[model samples]
Target: MKFTSEEDTYSWAVEFGKSLQPGDKVAMFGNLGAGKTVISRGVCKGLGFEGSVCSPTYTILHEYPNNPPIFHFDLYRLEGGADLYEVGLDPDYLSQGISLIEWPERLEGNDPGLTHIIRIEILNETEREITLEKI
Candidate 1:
């Protein structure tokens, strides 16, 4: 899907979030400022979260208290696989709630079943192409 504005991108994410279930993992691949956090905010909204949703870059992971819980992770600042393990995000969060991971390329071999991978590409300053694939 092509998003012409941030709102458009967020709306798409809200819709996608409605279809998510517990124990589901969504891997989001995108460059910085590609609206990844916007999409995540929409997901939190759709999941009934009423608080702010920010990128967990420094914190590694942020947990939201929604119906099924939302585990938002950003691996941009992570140095290596050990960082992920140290955060207790390897196999535990995968089975606990809905996991949305940004910069998922870092988790190369940790393939959680029934995963949805969303790749966001910046076509231009006002255009973003998002492709969601399930594996």
Candidate 2:
């Protein structure tokens, strides 16, 4: 879908996220400023989280306080699957609640049974094409 603004992208994600289940894992692909975080924030909102949802880039992960909770991850700093494992990205950890990952390309061989894959392509300064593929 074509989004003219970040809010549009966020709204789309909110609606999409409402359909997600407890064990669902989402893989998000996008470059810097591509609205990945915006979409994620929307998902958190849809999941009933009212607090701020920031990027977990430096922190590695952010766990929301909502029921069932939301495990948001940023793997931009990780070298590979091994590094991911070091940060408790294993099945046991992800199985605790819903997982949303950014820069999932870093986790190449480690597919955590992703339920949805979303790619946000930057078309222009304020335009983004967000594509969702259910796996």
Candidate 3:
């Protein structure tokens, strides 16, 4: 998908988010400032989260109390899945709700429940190439 602006990306993501359900997991892949959090916000909006959605970079995770709950994880500073444990993430919560993971490469463990993978490539200063695939 070619997104000429952030609104385009967020709009597309909102539609995608509406299709998610409990146990759904989405992994976001892109470089720094690639608008991962923007997509996340759109997803949360589509999921009926009325509050704000911000990046969990410093906090590592942000839990939104939606219908199925939203476990938003930013693993940019972490090394692997083991680090997730150290950060107080229960492996079981992943299956009970929706999950959005940034820097998913840090999660070395197998995530069979992951339902979607969103890869964004920067095409220029104002354009982005996004690929959304279902698992």
Give me the candidate number with maximum TM-score. Answer: 2
Better of 2 and 3 by TM-score: 2
User: Per-residue CA lDDT of candidate 3, range 1-135, in tens?
Assistant: 999999999998889889999889899999998989999999999898989999999999899998989999888988666455565456686777899988888878745357899999999998999999999
Backbone Cα, N, C clashes tallied per candidate: 0, 0, 0
Clashing pairs in 1: none
Backbone clash total for model 3 is 0
lDDT of 2 by residue, 1-135 (tens): 899988888898888878988888999999988998999999998888899999998998999987778999988898865455776677776777889999998887876789999998999999998889999
lDDT of all predictions: 0.84, 0.87, 0.87
Worst 10-residue lDDT window, candidate 2: 80-89
What is residue 20's positional error in candidate 1, in angstroms? 0.2
Angstrom error at residue 83, model 2:
4.5
**To one decimal, what is the Cα RMSD in angstroms of model 1 from the true structure?**
1.6
> Candidate 1: what lDDT?
0.84
lDDT of 3: 0.87
Candidate 3: residue 105 lDDT (0-100): 84
